[model samples]
Target: MKSSNFLKYTALLVFAIAIGFFAYMVNASKALSYLSHDPKACINCHVMNTQYATWQHSSHARDVGCIDCHLPRDNMVNKYIAKARDGYNHSVAFTFNTYKNAIKISDDGAKRVQENCISCHASLTSQMVKNADANHNYDDPSVATGRRCWECHKGVPHGKVRGLTTTPNNLGVKEVQ
Candidate 1:
C-alpha cells in the first residue's frame, strides 16, 4: 500500500472512532431527553435522584417542574440556550467527579430561579414590592435588598437537608416512561 493510502485509512479510522464514541455517549447519557420539559430527565443521572424525589413530594410537583423554576422562561431560545449551557457544565462536572458533595446553584442559576419565583408569584411579589417602597423597583438589586425567595423558604421543592448522602433513600425516585 502507498504511504498516502496508509495515512488516508488512518485518518478515516480515527474519524470513525470519534463518531462512534460520540454516538455511544449520547445514547448512554440519554442526552435527547434533556431537550424535553419532562422533570424526570433530571433524574437520568443518579446524582439528581434526591432532588427528583423531594420535588415529587413538594407542593409544586402538581403544577410546576424543574424546568419552570430552573430555566429562563422569557423565551424558547433563551430557555434552550441556558439549558444547553447548564447541560454542558453539568456533564463536565459529573464526568470528572469535580462537583461538590453538596451541590449549590451557580450565581446565574440563582438569578434565574429568583426571577422565576417572582414571575410565578407576581401578585404576591407585587404586593411585597409595594410594601417595601413606593418606587415598585423590586427587580433592582439595590432597591430589593438582594433577597432570594429561597432564603426564606429553604425547603421549597428540595428539603433543607441536601447532599449526596443526606437522602440515602432517594431511590424512591421512579423511572418515568
Candidate 2:
C-alpha cells in the first residue's frame, strides 16, 4: 500500500513540475503577446525586423496591421485556431533557428493574405473582377486561376522584402540586382 502511494505521489509531482516549466517558458517567451493583434508581436523574432520595418513605411501602415492582412476573417474559433497553429509553427522554427534567411510565406499563409486583400479592397477589386471575367477567356488557365492582388501590388505591405537580406538594424547586406 505504501509503495503504491509513493508511486502516485511521484507521478503527481512530475506532472506539477512539467506544468510549472511550461508556464515559465511561455512567460519568458512572451507567448501571450502573440494573442494580441499588435504588429509589434510579430517583431518579437529578430528575423521579422525587416518585414516590420518595411511595413512601417508601406501605405497600409496607417490602415491595417500584421494580423489584419495575415489572418483569416472567419469566426473566432477559426481565427484563434489559425493563430495558435501559426504561433506554434513560428515558435518551433524560431526556437530551432531553422527559418530561411529570406522569409517566405507558407501556402496557407499566402491563401489567407489573398483572401484578406480581396475582402479589404472589395470596392476596388470588384471592378477588376468584372473586367477580367468580361474581357478574358474564363476557361484560360491564367484567367481561370485568377490573379492574386499581390501579383501586381507586391509592394503594399512588405514591399519587395522577399529575396532581400539585411541585418536586424536595417542595414542591407545584399542589394537586390
**Pairs that collide, model 2:** none
Clashing residue pairs in candidate 1 (N, C-alpha, C atoms within 3 angstroms): none
Model 2, 1-177: lDDT tens digits are: 999999999999999999999999889888889989888789788878888877876898887999998888977887888888998999899989999977889999999998898788887667665676633323357656565667767788777555445334445543221
- All candidates: TM-score: 0.78, 0.75
After aligning candidate 1 to the native by TM-score, how far in Å is the CA of 113 from where it should be? 0.4
Task: State in Å the error of residue 100, model 1.
Answer: 0.8
Clashes per candidate, residues 3 or more apart or on different chains: 0, 0
Report the number of the highest-TM-score candidate: 1
Q: Stretches of candidate 2 above 4 Å error?
A: 1-20, 133-142, 161-177
lDDT of 2 at 132: 64
Residue 33 in model 1: shift from native, Å?
0.9
**Model 1 misplacement above 4 A:** 1-17, 133-143, 162-177
**Candidate 2: residue 103 Cα off by (Å):** 0.9
